[model samples]
Each structure stands twice: as C-alpha cells, then as structure tokens.
Target: MGTTTLIAVAATGLMAGVFFAFSVAVMPGLADLTPEHARGAMRRINARIQNPVFLLVFLGTAVVCGIEVFQGRIAGGLLYVLGCFVLTMAVNVPMNNRLERTDDAYWPEYLRKWTLWNHVRAACCLASTVTLLLGL
Candidate 1:
C-alpha cells in the first residue's frame, strides 16, 4: 500500500480501537455508577475528548479516507466516511450536544443510544481497515 492508504488503515484501526474501548470498558464502567455520577463523568469525558490528539485522529482519518476514495480505495474510504464519520456527525455528535444540555434523568436513554451508535462506529472503522488492507 502507498503512504496515504497505509495512514488510512492505521488511523481507522486506531479509531476502531478507541470506539471499541469505550463500548466495552468506559461505558460499562460508567453504567456501574449512579445516574448523576455517570452523567457527570460522561459530560466531562465528552468535553475532554475534544482535544487536539483525538480530533487529529478523528478528523484526520476522515480526510485521509476521503483522499483514498479519490485514489481508488473506494469501498474502504466510503465506509469510513459514511458509516463512521457521517454517522458520528449526524448522530453521535448531536447526541453529545443534547447530552450536554440534559439532566441526569436523560442519562439512561443517552447511555443506551450513544453506546449503540458507538458500536456501529467501531464496526465501521474495523471494516474500513480490513477493506483497505484487502484492497492493497
């Protein structure tokens, strides 16, 4: 694979790991807490996760994947962009925004829905990685 495709594979894999970790570990751990505590912790996490490193990997992966689409790795690139990136922007980020405005009462629904979408994101990234690798 060329450098850009390699980067897309790595970035997508990294993103997949991140979402998987959150789905399997972070969210579950938070579920053990009381709703208020869970909500507070998640709110803080949502805030903190917006930093440079995460944004670089998250947004950068989309950019790399977009480039790959033009470069002919269409399946993998589109999967990441549409399944992961678009879903994130269209669903997860909006949910996060609503979460910021929500009280603890909304936490249960938020947790359920957010984790569900996160699983989808993880799967998309994983599939994107595998598809890119296969195309090579």
Candidate 2:
C-alpha cells in the first residue's frame, strides 16, 4: 500500500477502535446506572459524547475509508463504507436530531434504535477493515 492508503487505513482503524470501545463497552456500562442521580450523570455523558461534532468526525472518517478503497479493487470495502455512510446520513442523523430535541426521559427507546444502527455500522466498518487488511 502507498503512504496515503496506509494513512487512511490507520485512521479508519483508530476511529473504529475508539467507536467500538465507547459505544459497545463504555456507553452500555453508563446506561446501566440504577439510581436517578447516576442515571442523570450517565445521560449527561451520553449527550455530550454523542454530539454533532462527534457525528461529523465519524462521517468524515468513513469518507476517508471510501477513498482508501479506491487504491485497489476494494469493491466490498467501498460498498460497505458507502452503505454505512448512507445509513448514517439517512437514518442516524435524523434520529440524532430527534434525540437532541427530546427530553432525557425518551432516551431509552432512542438508545435502543441507536444501538441497533450502531451495530450495523460497526459491522460494515469491520468488514471494510478486514477487506482492506486482506488486500481484497
């Protein structure tokens, strides 16, 4: 791989790692809080972490992944990344907009949907990562 391809892959890997750690591990633990005070604190953390800036960064990283795929016949990776990008723009963004407008009380339901979409995105990201790694 060229320098650009290596850089892109590294960036994608880093983004995916951070996202998996936070979304799958940290956020779930935070969401499991029991007491009202603790729940409130967790909610605040989630809100702060899932802000627009974070989404933009995530989207941008996916774009870089798409670009990296162009270095070779990484059609599968490109397709997966494109699918993820479309889903984020079409579904995730709107849901997040609703989340931002709503109260914390409605977060459980939103979080459920968010988690589902996030899992889909993570799968696609992983597929792309593996494809790139295998030089497929």
Candidate 3:
C-alpha cells in the first residue's frame, strides 16, 4: 500500500476502535453508574475527546478518504468519510450537543439512543477499514 493509504487505514482503524470501545465497553460500564455520575462522566469524556490528536485522526481520515475518492483510486475511503465524518456531523454530534443541554433525568434515554447510534458508527468505521484494506 502507498504511504497515504496506510495512514488512512490506520486512522480508520483507530476511529473504528474508538467507536467499538464505546459501544461495547464504555457505555456498558457507564450504564452501571448512577445517572448523575454517568451523565457527568459522559459529558466530560465528550468534551475531552475533542483534542488535537483525535481531531487529526477523525478529520484526517475524512480528508484522505475524500482525496482517494476524488483521485478515483482506492475509493474505499469514501465509506469511512461518509460513515464516520458525515454521519457524525449529521447525527451523533447533534445528539451529543442535545445531551449536554439535558439534565441527569434524561440521561438514560440519551445513553440508550446515543449508544445505538454508536453501534452504527462502529460498524461503519470497521467496514471502512476493511474496505480500505481490500482496496490495497
């Protein structure tokens, strides 16, 4: 694989791992917590996750994937771009934003809904990674 493709693959894998972790482990653990604690923790994590490195991998994958599609070479990356980036901007981030406005009383429903979307995100990203590898 070319260097750029490798980087895109790595970034997609990272994004997939993150979503899967939340879907499989993080939310389950948080589900066991008191509503107040769970909300607070989720809020903190959502805020903290918007750092430079995460942004690099998250946005970087989209950018590279777009390049791949535009170049007509290795179009597999478009999947990651659409699934992780577009869907996130369309759905997950909006929900998270609404989640921030909510009180603990609403956390349970938010958690359930958010995690359900997260499962989609996880599947998409994981599929993106495999698709990219196949393109190689």
**Top-TM-score structure, candidate number:** 1
Model 1 global lDDT (CA atoms, 0 to 1): 0.95
Write the residue-wise lDDT of candidate 1 on 45-120 in tens digits: 9999999999999999999999999999999999999999999999999999998897889999999999999999
Model 3, range 22-52, lDDT digits (tens) per residue?
Answer: 9999999999999999999999999999999
Instruction: Candidate 2: give the clashing pairs.
Output: none
lDDT of 2 at 19: 54
In candidate 3, residue 127 scores what lDDT?
83
RMSD in angstroms between candidate 3 and the native structure over all alpha carbons: 1.5
The order of the candidates by TM-score, greatest first, is 1, 3, 2
The candidate maximizing lDDT is: 1
Candidate with more favorable, higher lDDT: 1 or 2: 1
lDDT of each: 0.95, 0.64, 0.85
Where is model 1 poorest over a 10-residue stretch in terms of lDDT? Answer: 98-107
> What shift in Å separates residue 118 of candidate 2 from its native position after superposition?
1.0
Over 4 Å off, model 1: none
